[model samples]
Target: MSEKIEPTAAIEGAAPGAALSPAAQRALEEAAARRKAATAAPAPAEKGGPSGPEPTRYGDWERKGRAVDF
Candidate 1:
């Protein structure tokens, strides 16, 4: 029986079920790990600027600013 071929040139070294060569497998695993870590969470927004107030459950009605009627 013959081995099935993979589509990716990068992973061409790895077959469907066959174990990858040590160096190739390690590189692939490391790259995968890094990608996972990078996409794990969104970067935190910077704080302490007038960009906008953080959302609050309480309405801003407490402010004394003149109301604009539609």
Candidate 2:
């Protein structure tokens, strides 16, 4: 079996400034900014406000507001 590789190892190996063309570098920077913004945003308030009842954890067989049991 092949050894498992950490996801970030490939990212760390790249030199971002060395080979990217100007347009490619700009695109990369834009993507990074969007990623940062998404993570920094607050979690959305749940339905029915802060005092709402906790949502139910539906079973696997539930779909389209229906439940099926084998």
Q: Give Cα-based local distance difference scores for all models.
A: 0.56, 0.53
User: TM-score of each candidate?
Assistant: 0.39, 0.48
Q: Give the range of the ten consecutive residues with the poorest summed lDDT in model 1.
A: 54-63
Residues 1-70 of candidate 1: C-alpha lDDT, one tens digit per residue: 2554334344433555665555666787688778889999799978753355633324443323644232
lDDT per residue for candidate 2 within 15-62, as digits (tens), equals 633554445556666777788899999998667432443323433465
Strongest candidate by lDDT: 1
Name the best candidate (by TM-score): 2
Report the Cα lDDT for residue 56, model 2.
39
> How well does candidate 1 score on lDDT at residue 48?
53
